[model samples]
Target: MNLNKYPVTELSGNGKLVYGCDYNPEQWSREVWQEDVQLMKQAGVNLVAINIFGWAELESSPGNYSFERLDEILDLLHEHGIGVNLGTGTSSTPAWLTTLHPEILPQSADGVRAWPGGRQAWCSSSPVYREHALRLVEQVSRRYGAHPAVRLWHVSNELGCHNALCYCDVSASAFRGWLRNRYETLDALNAAWGTTFWSQRYSGWDQVLPPRTTISAYNPTQVLDFHRFSSDELLGYYSAEAEILRQHSTVPVTTNFMITAHIRTQDYWSWAPHMDVIANDHYLDHRLEAPTIELAFAADATRGLAQGSPWLLMEHSTSAVNWQPRNIAKAPGEMIRNSLAHLARGADGLCFFQWRASVQGSEKFHSAMLPHAGTDSRVWKEVVELGGILERLTEVGGSTVTAEAALVFSWEAWWAYDRESHPSSDIAYLDQVHAAYKALWEAGITVDIVAPGADLSAYKLAVVPGLYLVRDSDAAALADYVAGGGHALVTFFSGIVDENEKVRTGGYPGAYRELLGIRTEEFLPLAPGDTPPLDNGTAASLWSEALRLEGAEAMVSFTGGHLAGTAAVTRNRHGAGTAWYLGTALEPAALRETLTQAAAGAGITVASTPEGLETVVRSNGDRSYVFLINHSHEEHKHAIQGQELVVGEEVADVVVVPAGAVRVVRTSTPAHPTNGLPTGSKDVESD
Candidate 1:
C-alpha cells in the first residue's frame, strides 16, 4: 500500500508561499477594510482567511442571514489580487440559536451548561447545533463557492479546539449511539469496556452514558471510549459541514487542526484523511525548557499528518499571543525565522491569526501583521520582509522533507498510556516521544512522525517510545518490519496492553516478548527525583524494568536499585535486522549514545550538528533546499556552500548564520559531504 500518496500543492493560483493573515472585515469599518487591503498589497499578501468567527454577524437571528458587508469585503480583496480562504462562519453559533436551543450548549462533566460568552460553546453531538451549523455552511458555500476570490474552503476555524469533549445529555446520547455502531451488542460493549469490574456491566445501551462526574474515579476503559467517541463526534460535525460545502464548492476544503501532541482532544491521524488540504494552527508552548525544539516537533508532526505532503500554516502568532500568561513578544528577526522554520518543514502557505490586531474582545492583545503600533513598527517591517522572501522562494512549494528514520506516534497509545493506574504517573507519552525526537533532531537527523500502521519499508530505523497500547495488527506490522531487515528501537512499557486497554496475558511487554527476545517480569518505577546508575555510567530515572533475555543480548544493566544487574537495555537479531529494547528511561546523553550506536549498526549516517542550530533538507527530486536555522545568541559559521535562496546570493565556502536568523540554501549538489559531515565541520559523532 502506498501510504504517502496525497499531495496538496497549491490552494491559491500561484505556487508561492502564501503570505497573508486572518482578515476580519466585520471587526473593522468599510474605510479600514480598504486600508487593510492596501496595506496587505504593500506587504505582498496574496491570500486572506476571512469569516472565521462571523456567525453572529452573518446570522443576526434564526433563518435571517446577511452578506452585504461580506460581499463587499470579498470583492475588494479580489480586486486587490488577493485570494480568499473562506471560512464557513460556523466555529461559533450566534446567540439567538443558543437562546432558542439551550441544549445545543455543551455541559461540563459536572453538568453545568457552558454559557455563550466564549466561542465553541455548542455541543458537537447536538443534532440541533449540527443542523444549524450545516445550514449556515450551506448558505455561505452557495454564496462564495464559485467566487473569483475563493481559493480554499476553510470549514470552521479550529474544530474541537475549545469543546472536544462534552458530557451533556446530547453528547451522552450520541456516545451511546456511537458505541452501538462499534460493538453492536451490549455484551460486546461490556467486554470491551470491562464493565464487569465494580458491577458496572450495562444491561442495555440506554443504561450507558458518558463518563460523567461520579463520586469516585470513572472506569478507564469507559473514559477511553468516550475520548474516541468525542473525537469522532467532532470529526462527524466537520465532515457534515465539509460535505455540504462540497455539494456547492469545487475548491479544496479544510479545517485548521490544532495538531499538538499536548492537546489530546482530537486524533488528527483520523482527521487528516477527511481534509482536502491539511491545515494546522500551531502555537509554541513557551513554558517548555526548549520551545524551539517543541515548535519543530509540532511542525514535523503536522507534516506527517499530511502524509509528507505540503500543508498550510493556517494560524500562528505574529508576536505575543494574548492567551499565554507572560505573552512574550518575538525578538527582532525571530518572526521570519519562525515562519521559515515552518516552511522548511512542509508548510506551503504562511498565515497569522489576524491581519490587524483586535481592538476589543478576548484576543485584543494578540499580535498580528499590523499591530496596534501601526505600519511604522518593527512587526510590520518584518512582515513585509517575509513576504518578499517568500516571493523569491516560490520553488519551495510542493517540496517534501524525506527521512530514513521514523518514529511511531499514536494518539490511541497516548490516550491509554497516561491512565491513572499506570506504573509511573510521571511517564508522559509526548514527553518520551519528544525526548527521542529531540535526540535525533539535535544529531542533525530528520525524523518522520508516523502512525503505527505506516509502511516501514522506506525507513532504515523505527523508534517506538512508550507504546503502552499496542493493537494486534500494529504489533505484527512492527515485527514484520524488523524481520524484513528494518531496524527498530522499542522502549519500555511497550506492547503491555491491547486495544481495549486490557493487559496482555502471560508477561510484561506481552505481545512483543517473543519478537523482542526479552521478557520483562516486573516494572521498577522509580521515585521522584531518584536517578539510579546504569552499567554504562549513565543514570536511569522515571522507570526501569526487570528483564530476562530469551535470545537478546544485554547491552546495558542496572547498577543499583532493586532490579540491580538486570538488563536495562537489550538487542536481539531477528531475521535479517535487529530490535533494541530499552527497559528503562536513560539520561539524555545516554539515550543519544544508545540511539547513535543503533543507527550506526544500521549504516545510517548521523549529521554532526552544532549546538543551537537546526538543519532540515527539503527535496523535489531535482533540487534540494537546505535550511539552517541558528537559534542561538551568537553568530555561527557553517561550511555549507550553495545559492542562498532567501538572499539570492551564492555562498561558495563558509556562511555566517547570525544569531536567531535563518538561511535557506538551494543547491543541486547534496548538502552534506561524502563523510556525512559538512566541510570544515567542527563537531564529530564518536561511537
Candidate 2:
C-alpha cells in the first residue's frame, strides 16, 4: 500500500530496520570517529544522524562555508557501510549571524530576548533569518544531495522546541499581515476576535499585536488566534526550507516533533501533511503518576499523525535523561522494554538522542549508547542487545497498526480550554483525556488519537473527553456520524465554545446538547479532593453537572453533594447507534468497566488482559507481528503458534517472554473481508 504512496524504501527498511542514534561527530575529535564506527558495526547500527547542531561548525562566519570535516565524516561512515541521516545544520543561528543581526533573535511574550547560549534562538517569522537559513540549506542540499551515504534529510533538529511564539516587532508585523490575509476587513477581525470586549477593536491592522503581557487576561479569542498564527508561522518557516531541500535532494525530509507530556507548541495535525514522513522525539516525564502510560499514549498519537503508517522514533534516552529534575536511571532491562513498546505501537525506526555520551556540554550527564561507564556497563550491553533484536524483526517494518476505536484529541481545544476562566481550576484539559485513554489501555483496547474534525466513520467507537471547542460543521458531522451507526462516549466540559472561544449560548455543553439528548443548566464543581459517591456503587470527583433528561435515560445518578439524585452518566439511543455521556471523573477501573459495557454494539470487543503485560499487533496484509512487552518481573507465557523472532525459535503453542524483555512473533495474518484489519475476539487481539 505504501509503495504507491512512497517510492523510497530506505527509511521504511527494505530488509533491515534503521538502528542508531544521533551521531554528533562534530562534538568529538577525528581520532574517535573510527572507534565509533567500529562500535556501531559491532552493535548492528546501520543508520546514524549527524550534524544536527553543526551550524557554527559548518559556517563559522557569514557567507563563509567550510565542510572538510563533514566530508571526511560522511566518507568514513560510508566506508563502514553505514547510511547517513543528514541534517541541514540550521537549527541554531551561528554566533556571527546573531551578532550581526541581534533583532533576528526571538523574544518571550513578556519581551525578554532569548540569547545565543541555547539553540533555536532565531525568530521563526524573521525574513532576515529565513534568508540566511535557506541559503545554508541550499548549500548543504546541493553539496550532499547525491552523496552515496545520504538516506534521509533532516530539516531542523526540532522546529518549535523552544521558540514557537515570538513577541518582537518583526513578528508583530508578520502577525498583522497574517490577520489581514485571514480577515479582509477590520470589522470582520474585530467580530471574530471579540475585540469589542476591552476597547481592543483594531481600526488599523498595525494596532493588533500578539496577546502579550496585558493588564489582565487578554481576549481569549485573540490568544487563540495568536496560537493559530504562531503555529502557521512555524510551518511556513519549515516549508521554506523543505522547498529548498526538495529542489536539490530526493531524500524523504522531516523534522523531529516533540510529542511528549510537555512541549505543546505546534498543532501537529496541521503540520503532519507537510512532512514527508512523520517522526517524533519522545522522553518519559518522571513527574507523572503513570509515566509508561504516557509513553504509550505519545507513541499512539505519533502513529495517528502518520495516519496508521509506520513512523520513526527519532530521539529517546538510553537510561536517564539529563533534563529531568530527578534523572532516574532506567532499570536493568527497562530500556529494551521501552524501545519495543514504541515499536509495538508502530515505530519502524528506533533511534536515541546521541550515539555516545558527552563529556562537556549542556547534556554532558545524559545517558547514551556508549555511556560514561564504557562498553562493560549494563546500558551498553542492553543497547547492543536491542540493536540485534531490531535487526531480527525486519518483517515488522512498514506494517500498519490496527485500530477499532478513536480517541478525539485537539491541540486547539488544549489551547482554548486551559485559558484563565473556567468552571473549575482543578479540571485540566488532559486529565480526563488521559483517564479515558488509560481506561481503554487497561482493557487491552487500541485507539487512534484523532483530531476533533477527523472522520469517525472508519471507527466503531469514538471517545471524546474534554473537547472544549468545536466548530458547528464539525459538531454536525459528529452527530451525523453517530446517527449513521457509530457509537460515541463524550465527557463533560466539552462543546462549551466555538472556534472564537465564544459561548455556544443555549445551555452548558452547548454544541452537543441536542445530539446527546440531555439538557444541563449549570456546572456543579466540587472543591479539591472531594470524591462524591454515585448511585451505581462508584465515586466521582473534580466536576459534576446538574442535568435533566430530554430523550436520554440515566445510567448512573449522584447519591450525595449539592447535585444530589441528578444524572451522573446517561445513555441516549440515537437513530442507529448510542451515545454515552459522563459528567464526572470516575476511577480507572470504574471507567474501564463502563467503557467495556458501552462497547456492545460497536463492532469491537473489550477483553481483559494480564496485570502487567501489553499486547499489540501490526500487519502488512500477508503477515502479522505480535509484540509482547512484559514490564513486570515474572516471565509470562502466551498461547501463540508462530516463529518467535526475538529468540529465533519456532514455538508450537506457547511463547515464553522473560522478565522485562520483549518478544515478537511472526504469524500468518488473519483474513478480514472488508477493511483487512484484525478484528474478532481476544485470541485474535481485536479485543
Candidate 3:
C-alpha cells in the first residue's frame, strides 16, 4: 500500500484547486470556442480535457494526419491560462481505418461483430488495431508531451469501457498466450481450470478458447480465467500506449477509471499502480435503491486504489444523465451536495464529462457544465458555484481522507461470485459490500475499501463481506489481522472458494473456518422474497449456513427458518481480538445495528449525530477542514466554531446548514487527534 502523496502536484498550479470539465472543441464551431473560453473564465474553470474522442479529426484518413485544428485549440486554451488534460484520441476508432480493416472490430461471444457506429469498437487483442492506435498515440504524445498547456497525459477514454472482452479469433489466440504465461504448460492449466469435470480436458494449448457462448453453464474456472484475460488484455493495451507516452513526456499519465457500480470490466486494483494520479469517473446510479450510498462506496474504493491518498474526481454529471433507463434530473442544489461529498472523501480535482451539452449525438441529452438551456440554466449556476467552492479548498489538495475501519474489496471475487451458477443469485457481492458500507456510513464511520492482500494493521475493524474468491495468502492476512488485535466481521457465503474458484473440500468457508471456530455442514440458501425471523427479534435473509460452533458463542440464532435452532451469527476470540461470523444475511436495519455494535466493540467512536447529516474531515499538518452535507430536507445545526468557507461567515458555536446544502468549516484544530478525541469526531487518519 506504499503510495506517493498526491504525485500529480502540477494539477494544482500555484495552490489553486482543479475545477474543470472535458472540452470537445471538435464538437463546436470556431466562433463558439471563443465564447466557451470566455465563459470558462467567468465560471472559474482552470483546466479542460480535449481530444478524448478526437481520432476522426486527428487523423482524417490513413497515412494522412492533420493537427492544425488541434494546434489552434491548444494555443487558444493556453492563451487563456487554462491547462489541458490531453487525451490520445484513440478511444473511438476512425471509420476510415475500420472500413479498411474490419478484422480490428470486436466480436461478441456468439460470433457477432460490433460495428464502428459506436465508440470502442476495436478488439483489444487485435494487432491491427494496436498498430493504428499506437501510431495515433505516438503522434499525440510526441506533439503535446512537452506542450505548455499539457498537464496530464490521458492515455485513452476509459480503456476497457466497451471492448473488454472480444470473443474473436484474435482474442482467443491472445487469451491462449496469456494463459500460457500464467500456467506455463497445458497440465498446470488443466489442473487450475479443473477441466477434468466435464470431459473438457485440453491436450494442447491450441485447444483452449475464450470461454465462448457455451451450451449451458460453462466451467467456472474457465470463465474466471477469461475474465482475468479480458481485463489483462485491455490493461496490456493501456500499458502499451502509456509506455509510448512515457517515452515522450514527463507529465503524469492516467485515464479516467470507471469506478461506478455498473462497469466492472477492468480490475482497478491491478491498474492503480500504473496510474501516476488516480482518477475515476463516477455517476449517480439512479437505478439503485440508494444511489447516494453507492456513490460513497465508489469514492472510498477509488481512494483505496491510491491507498488512501487524495484522488481526482475525473467525471460526474451536473444534472440528468442520458444513459440510464430513467434519466432523473437532480433537484436544485443536489449537484452541489454531490460534488462536496466527493471532496469530503479525498477528491482534489472536480471535473465533469463535457463542457457543453451536445446538439447532436448519442450523448446530446447528457448533462454538462453548460447544458442545452445555456448560461441561464440551474446547472450552469451550480457549476460556477462549485468552481468557487473548489477555489476555497486549495489547502485540501494533498490532505488524505480519514478512516477507522476497512472493507476488503476484490474484483476477482466480483467476477467469480456473479457467475451463472450460484446459491441465491439475489445475494450479490456488491449488495453485501454496500450493505456493510452503508451500515458503517450510517454509523458515522469513514472506512477504507482495501484490496484483500493490503495490510490491515492500520484499521481497528475489518469487514469482509461476500468475498467468495480469495487467495490463500490474503485469507491468511485477514486471520493475521484479527489475531493481531483487529476485529473482523466475516459474513455468509464468504471464504468458500480459493483463487481458482475451487471449493475448500472439508467444509464451507474453507479459508477461515479454523479462525472463526465454526464448521458448516451445508448451505441453507433461502428462496427469493423469504425473510425468516431470527430469535433476536430481527430477520435472516438471502443466505444461511447450517453450522456448528466449535469454540465460538452464538450471538444470534434462527427461529423460523429451515434450521430453526442453528446459529445465525457467531463471535469467537482468536488472540488479542475478536472474529464475528454472520451465517445468514440480516435485514438492512438489523445489519446496520450489528455492524454498529462491531464498530463500537472495536473502540471506534460511533457518532451520535442524526443519519442524514454526513460528516467527514480532511487534514493537513495542523489545520482541519470539516465538511457537512445535509441529505435530508430539514435544516440542521452543528456545534462547530470555525469560519465557513462556502458562505464566508464565522461561526462562534453552532453552524447552520440549510436543507440540501453543503458546508465546509475551516479550523486550526488537528483533524487526526491521537488522544482525548472529542465525541462525534471521525477525523483520525487510517495511517
Candidate 4:
C-alpha cells in the first residue's frame, strides 16, 4: 500500500478529526432517536456509526426486509449534518435464519453447535452463512451507496471476534481445501507437518481434519496450520462482504480490528491490505500489571498495521467496560489521556463502542458517550469536553509519526512460540515484545511495529523479540537489512523453527546465526521461579541460551549457574551495520539499560524524559506536532518551545504537563529528515 497517497487528511474528506461512537438507534424508539441526535450534536459528534446489530430488525424473515427504521435514522442524521459510518448489520445472523438452518451455527472444538442467543453465531466457512451475509450487505449498500450522509462503509462489526475458529464439518472441509491449495499434495502436507513421527500420515485430502480435541495434545504443526486456516477463513468472509459492498458503493470500506498483540488468532498484517481505512477497537487490559504500557503498545502496533498511514480508533471506552472480571472505571482525565495517547501515535478518528448506554442488553453496564445517568452524568461531561478538544486539535490530523527504531512483530512466530512443549512455557511472545516496547516508550522514543517483510530501510535500529518461526525470505530480508548498516536486537528463542514448525538444521537461530555471528550450543531454560545471575548485578529468568561467539564480542555474560561465564548477550559487526543477540531474557532494569545503550549505538536519539512522561512527535515534512503526556500522579515540566495547539497558548521554554494531562505543541523543527537515506527504501540505513 502506498502510504503517502492515503494520508489522514485525504482519507477523511473534510480533514476534521472524526469524533463519534457506534450509534445504535434501533435500541431506542423513534421518539428517543431525536433526543439522541440532539445530545450527539451537543457533544460535537460529527460521525455516527449505525446498523451494527440490526440484522434481526432489518430482516424479520428470509427474503423479507424493512428499511423504515433505517431510513428515519439516516434522514435524521443527515438533517443534523452528522455523517454516517453505515454498517451492513451482518455481524449476527438473524434468529429466523439460524432457526431454519442450524447448520450455519459454528461448532465448538468439542463438537457442540453454538446457540443463537448472542452475536456472531454463524460459521465463517459455511457457504450458507456467507450467502445470507453477502445478500444483506448488498441490500444495505444498494440502499445507502450514494447517500449524502454516508461517508464510510463499515463491513462488519469486529470480524471473527467470537467465532474465529470453528471445528464444524463444514470448516473441516474448508480447512482441507485450504491446505490442499497451500501444499498442493498430501505428501507435501505430511512432510511439512512431520506426520512420520507417530505413524500418522495422511494418504488422502479427505482424511485431514480441523485439529479437533485430541487424546494427547494435538500436533503442533497441525494446530498451527489450523490456526492459519481459521484466520484465512475469517478473512475470506470479510473479503466476500467487502467485494459485494464495493460493487454497490464507491465509499471507503473498513471493518474494526481487535488489534491486541496478545490475540494471536487474527493476522492483521494480512488483513490490512483489504481495508480501505485501518480501524482498530482497543480496550484497556486491566489484567496486565501495566495497562497503560499495553495501551501504548497496542496503539503503536495499530498504527504500524496501517503501514504508518492514518488509521481510526473505531472503538474504546468513555469509562468502565462491561466485560473483564473486575470492571474498573476510568480515573479523572484517564479517558482523555488514553484518547490522546492513540492520537499521538497516529489515529485520525476517535470513536467509542457506543453512543448511548444500553438500557436492556448484556452491555447495559458498558459506558458510552451518554451514560445511563443521561446528559447530567460525569461521563457525558467528559465526552463533551473531549469532543471540544478534538475540534481544536484538528491540525494534528494528516500528520505522521516517524520512528528511528522499528520492532518486528510476526503473528506466525507468535503461534509457534506460544505452543506447548516449549523450552519454557512462561516465555510469552507478546510479553517479551511489550517489555522491549515499554522500555522504549518510557524513554520517550517512538517505535514502529512492522512486519518481518516490511521495508526496514528507514529505521536505524530494529528489535525482534522471540521470533521462533523465521521464514527463509524474512530471514534473508533481515540479513540484508543488517548488512546495509541497519542495527538489530535479536532475542532468545528466535530463528529456531521454520514456517512449517520444523526445527532448522545445523544450529539454533539457524538463519540468523551467521549474520548475528553467534552459535548456540544448547538452550538453558530456567524454571518458573529460577533466576540466574548475570553481569552488572542483573539476573536472567524464563529463558537462557549457551552461546559461543564466532565473530561477535560478548556484551554481557552469565556469572552463575551451570552456564556461568557463557555469553548472555553479544554484539556482532556485520558489514556496515551491527547485530546484537540477547541469549537470555534479562531483568527489567538491565534490559532497559542495554536497550538504551544499543539505541544510542545505532545513532537513534532518545529524549531525556521524566519517569512517567511520554513524548511523541508526529511530523508532516518540516512541521512537527509534539505530544507531551504525563501518565504519573506527579507533575512534570519539560523544556519545550512551540505553539500549544490544544489551548491555543504560546509555550516558551518550560511547559508544565500536569498529572494525567496531555499537551500538544506545534513546532517548526522537522522530526526526521532523509539525510542521504535512500528514498523508497525497504530496509534500515547506516551512518
Candidate 5:
C-alpha cells in the first residue's frame, strides 16, 4: 500500500513529519520575517502556506502585475529554510477586477448580489472571472516556477463562499449548457427534472433559465439544482486554475476544502478527482468532544477523492476560533491531542489556520501560534512544546495505518433531506449522521468515513445512516457489496431519491426496495414526544415510512397509529449476504442497539467500553499504528489484547489517562523503536 495513502511528508528516509502551519509574512516587515523563521525552527515547523490573500498585492490592475513583494517573501523563506505551499491568490477577487466587472461578484440564492468585502465571492460561471483568475495563476506559477521554498501549489482560498450558481444571465447560459451536456435531449431533461408538474415543460434547451424566480418560483428542485450547478461551476474555477499550475509546476496542487462548513453546498466528492492532494479545514464550535469524528470523516472523504490516499489536516485551530458563538480555548492539551488525533484518523500533515495571530481585521481574533500579544502567550508555548516533541519523533509522518470498517457519507443524501420542506422542521441530517458516527466510534470500530462509491469489498461492514439520496450507482455498489457476503445497514429516508433530488418512481425506499425487502406505502411524520401513538414509546421523529415486507421479516413495529402494523425493520437476503433496512428514525439508544446487533452480524468487535476513547488503526505493509485517544472529561480504564502502546511500554489489563488525553502505540511484530533513528532526533526543515 502507498504510504502516501496515509497522510505524512517525507523529509528523509525513515524520518518524516506532516508539514507545518500557514505563515503570513504580508502583515509583518522583513525584520519580523527573520524572527518568525527563527521561532519556526524552534517549533520544528517545516511547511508554510503563503500568498493566500495576496491577490491585490500580486496584481494592482487588470494587466499590470507586481511580484517584488512576493519575491522577497519567497526568497527569504527559502533562505531561512522554510517550505511553502504557494497560493495562486485567486480566492478573493482583486479589487480592480471586481470594480471593472461587477458581474464577477457572486449572486446569492434569493438573487441578491454579494458586494465585495469577504472572500469566495466571485461568480464562478463568468468568463471574464475565469480569464482573470487563470491569468493570475499563470503569472504566479511562471514567476515562482522553480523557487526552492515553494513545495506545493494552493489553487485558491476556501471554495465555500462562491455559492456556485448565480441568477445572472451568464450563469443561466452556463446552466443551460451544463444541462444540455448532461442530457442531450429536451425529453430527457424534462423527465429528469419531473417538469410534468406545474406545467413546466420545455420546448427547447433555450427555455432553460437560471434556477430562480426568473425561470421558476421558489421550487426546491430548482434550489437544489442551482446548488449542484454552482458547486460544479466553482469546481470549474478550481480546475481551470489547477490546470495552469499543473502545466507550469511539478508540485502537487490542492485547495483548503471546508467540507463540514459547506454541508449544504460544495460537493467535495465531485471535485475530489481534480485535486492532486486533498487538504481541508476542520473547526467546530460546539460538540467539541465529537468533532474529531468529523475530522476523521473529512479525511476519509478527501481520501475517497485521492483514491484512498491520506489527506492533509490543513487548517485546524490551535485553540479557539473567533467564528464560534463562544470562542473557547482548546482546554490545556486538547489542541495537541486533537492534532495527533488527525494523524490517527489518516491525516498526512498537520497545519493550523493562521501562523501569527492578527491584531486587526476580521481574522485578527482567530487563534494562532503567536497571538496579538506576541510570543509570550500560552498558545505559542503550546506550539513550541508540541514542536519539541515532533522534533524528537520520526514515525509521525508517512506511516501506515489500517481500518476494517467504513461509514458511507452521501452529500447527495444530505442535500435531499436538507432541501426537503419536511412536516417537522427539526429532521436534522447532520445530527443523525453524527449520531451514527458517535455510536460506531464508541463501539471501538476503526471507521473510514467515505462517500458512496468507495470500495466496501475490503470492509466487513458498511454503515449507511439516513442515506436519503441513493444514486443508482451507489445503490448498485452497496447491493453488490452485500451480495458478496459483506454486511450493509441502511436507515430510513434512504433509497428514496436519486442524485438529482428527484423521488424514485417505484414505491418507497426507491431502487433498493428489493435488496432491503421492504416497500413503503406512506410516510408518518411525528412530533417530538408523539411517536406513531405507540405505547412502546420508542423515540421516532419528523418522518417515518410505513413499509410492507416482500421477502424479509420485521424487527419492530408501531404499537399504534394508522400504519402501526407495518414493518418498521426488515432484513432481506441478497446474494450471499444480507441487507437490513430501517423504516423510521430510531432513538439514539435504539440505534446503538441496532448497530451493535448489525455489527455483530458482520463480525466486528469493540476494543473498550468507555465513551470518547476512540481508536483507529492505519497500516502500511508490515507495520501498523494504533491511535488510542480518550476525549472525555474524566479519566477512563481501557485495554486491548495483543497490542503494546509504544508511548510508555507497559502491558496491563487497564490504562488510565486524564481527560482529553491521547497516545500513539506501535504494535508491529518484532516491535521496533517507534522512532526510526537510534541516536539523533528527526531533522525538520521548513518547506
Candidate 6:
C-alpha cells in the first residue's frame, strides 16, 4: 500500500492544530518580550518565525557584524520551548550598500529607479546586490545553522513584492543571456517571435537587450520576453539563497509566499522541491468570500509540491490585518475559525503575522496575540482557547494527506498573460483560474492546486484554464498524460506561445494543435455583454475565438459577430482518453456545465454535498477525511458521506456553523497503518 510520512490526522473529527506566530522582538522592548512568550505559551503557540527583517540590524557596515541582540532573542525563544523557522535576514538590503552602489537599487517598468524605502527593493540582476546578499545569507546560515530550536530555514522574506519588473543594464544583459539560451540562432529567435513583420529581427547578439522602452518596441513578443526574463531573474535570487542555506543547513528551506499579490514572481512549483515545508502569509479582505476555499487551493498547491506533504500556515492574522482598505477586526470566533480552516485544508502548522501588537511603524495597527488593549482582551482569550485545543491534539501534529485530482496552475502562464497584449485587456488570468477552481469547489470535488509537470498518474484528470505559455516538454507531458489514459481539460489562450514567449507559427494553439485537434485561424474578440450565439442556440461573450475542428468534434459553436457556427468547445480522443478544449470564455453557468461534462469523461467523482459548501478530502492509506465548510453567511444543510469520522451525532440538515462558526465531524475509522502517515485526517473545521 502507498504510505505517506505525515498523513492527515483528526482528534475525533476536530482537526489537528499547529500553533505558531511571527515573533519580532526587534520591534519590542525586552520587558515586552517576556510578556509575548508568556502569552504564546498560554495560546499553545509552538513555532516561531524570527528575524524576518533583521539584515539592517545584523550587518551595520562592511566587514562588521553584530548578533548580540539576536543571540539573546534566540536563546530566550529556545528556553521557552518554541520551534523556530529561522530567517536569513537578507531580504532587505542594508542602506550602506544601496548608498555606495546605487546600481543595487531596482528600476521600475517605466524605467524609474526605485528608492530603497521598502523591503525587497533591491535589483535582482545587479551583481553587487547578489554578491552582498549572498555573503550576508552565508554568514547568517553559518552562525545560526546549528541552533537546536531551528526547524526550517526561511530564505529571504517574501522575495517578490511590488514593482518586481526591473529594467536596468544588469537586467538587459541577463535578458540577452536568457534569449541566447532559449534560441541558439538569431534566425530561430526572429522566426519564433515573428519579428520579420515589424523590422525587429536582430542582426547580432549584441543587438538584443531587455525589453525596455528604448529597444523593446513595446510589441507583444517584447513584452512577453521581458516578463519571462524578470521571472527567471527573481528565481535566480531564490536559487542563490537556497544554495547558501543548503550548504550549511539540513532542514527544509522556504520563503514566505503571500496571498493575492505579486502573482508573477514567486513560482512555488519551481521552488517547492527545495522547501521542507512551504509557508504562506494569508491576509484577505473580510468582505471577500471567506478565504477558506482559497486556503484549500493554497494547501493543495503546497502539498502537490512536496508530493502530498503538509505545509505551514506561516502568517495569518490573530485578530485584524492593517493592510486592507479598512482594517477591520476579525469578528467573534472568526480568528479561530480561520485557523481551523487552514488545518481543514491540510496545514501542519498555524502561525500569525505578529505575536504582539507592533508598537510603531506600518504594522502598528495590525492585530496580534496581544492586542493593543492588552492581555485580557477578547482577541487574547480566543488565541488562548485556540492554543488549548492544539495542546489537546498533539497526536496528529505532523501529518499529511494525499490528493486524487488536481488542477494545473502555473506562474509562467500568469506572467505571460500579463504581457500578451491581447485584444482584450480586461481578461484577467488569475480571475479566470479562480473561477475554474470555484466551480470545482462548488461541485464538491476534491481539487489539488498543481503546477506544470506535476505527476498526472495519481489524478484521473487535470484542468488548466487560461494557459497562455507552454514551455519545453510541457506539451509533450500533457500529450503523454492523455495518451496514457489520463484526461486533460484546457481552456482559451493556451498553446499560443513557446518557452521563448514567441508564438507558435503553424496554427493557433500551435504546439497543442494536434493534441487539441483544432486550428484557431481567426482571432475573434467579443466585447462584454455581446452575444456570440453558439450551435446549441446559446449565446456567450467575454472573448471568443472562431475555431474549426481538424480531427476533433465540436461541443459548442459560436454563432454571432461573423463567427456563427464556429467551434467554441471541442474534444479529441487520444489513446483511450480525451482532450477537451474551450475556445471562448463562457459565463459561470456554461463554464460549470462544461467543467462537469469534462470531468465526467475522466470518471472523476464529485462529492454528494450541497452547493457553496467548500469541500476538501485528504486521504492516507485506507482512511480519508473530508472537510465540508459552509462559507456562506446563510445556514445550509450539507449531505456528506465517505466513512464518517467526527464523533458528534450526524444531523441531516447539519447547521453548518454560520459565517464564523465551525463544525468538526468524523468521517472515518482511524486505523494506523505500518509505514503510513501518523494520522489519516485530523483537525477539520470551518472558521
Name the candidate that leads on lDDT.
Answer: 3
Candidate 5: residue 193 lDDT (0-100): 79
Model 2: per-residue Cα lDDT over 1-687, one tens digit each: 121154223753344777879999988888899899999999888888998988889899887899999999999999888888899998988889999999999998899988887889999989999998999999999999999898888888888888898999999999999888998899999999887786787888878888889768778888888889999999998888889888988877888999887877789999999888788998888988788888999999999988887788988998899888899999998888899999989888889988999999899999999999999999999999998898788777778777788899988998888888778889888887889988888777778889887899988889999999998887887889899989999999999999888898878778889878998988989888888999878899888887889899999888887778889899998889888899888878889888877765576755555767787878787777777888878887777677889989996777787878788887775523212223331332222
> Which model is ahead, 1 or 5, in terms of lDDT?
1
Candidate that scores best on TM-score:
3
Model 5 local distance difference test score: 0.71
RMSD of 1: 2.4
Candidate 5 Cα outliers beyond 4 Å, as residue runs: 1-8, 11-15, 214-221, 287-290, 421-424, 532-538, 561-565, 640-655, 670-687
The lDDT per prediction is: 0.84, 0.84, 0.86, 0.84, 0.71, 0.70
**Per-candidate TM-score against the hidden true structure:** 0.96, 0.96, 0.97, 0.96, 0.91, 0.86
The alpha-carbon lDDT assigned to residue 213 of candidate 5 equals 53
Query: What is the lDDT for 277 in model 5?
Result: 71
The window of 10 residues in a row where model 2 has the poorest summed lDDT is: 673-682
Please write out the lDDT profile of model 5 over residues 1-687, one tens digit for every residue: 122432347421124565477777888888988888888777778788899988888888877998898898888777777788888988888777888889988776467898988776777788998888888889999888787788778888877545545777788889888878878899988887778888888998788876665443445565667677778888887888877887877777878887773345787778776766777777754645456677656565566555556677778888888876778777888887877777776676778878888777888889897777778878888888777555543454555445556788866667667754554566767767777777776665556667886788877778888787777988899988999999888877777778766778778878788788778877776666776633345756556776788888877776676776777766788888988887777766677777777777777653334666666665655555556677778775544323344345553433455577765555443212321211111111100
CA-only RMSD, every prediction: 2.4, 2.3, 2.6, 3.8, 5.6, 5.1
Model 1, residue 439: C-alpha shift (Å): 0.9
Better of 5 and 6 by TM-score: 5
Query: Which residue window of length 10 is worst by lDDT in model 4?
Result: 678-687
Model 1 residue runs over 4 Å out of place are 1-9, 670-687
Ten contiguous residues minimizing lDDT sum, candidate 5 = 678-687
> What lDDT tens digits, residue by residue, belong to model 6 across residues 316-363?
887778867777777777787677667766676778888888888888
- List model 1 lDDT by residue over 562-597, tens digit each: 778888899999999899998888888888888888
Cα lDDT of candidate 1 equals 0.84
What lDDT, from 0 to 1, does candidate 3 have? 0.86
Q: On lDDT, who's better, 2 or 6?
A: 2
lDDT for 75 (candidate 1)? 95
Q: In model 2, which regions exceed 4 Å deviation?
A: 1-4, 7-9, 12-14, 671-687
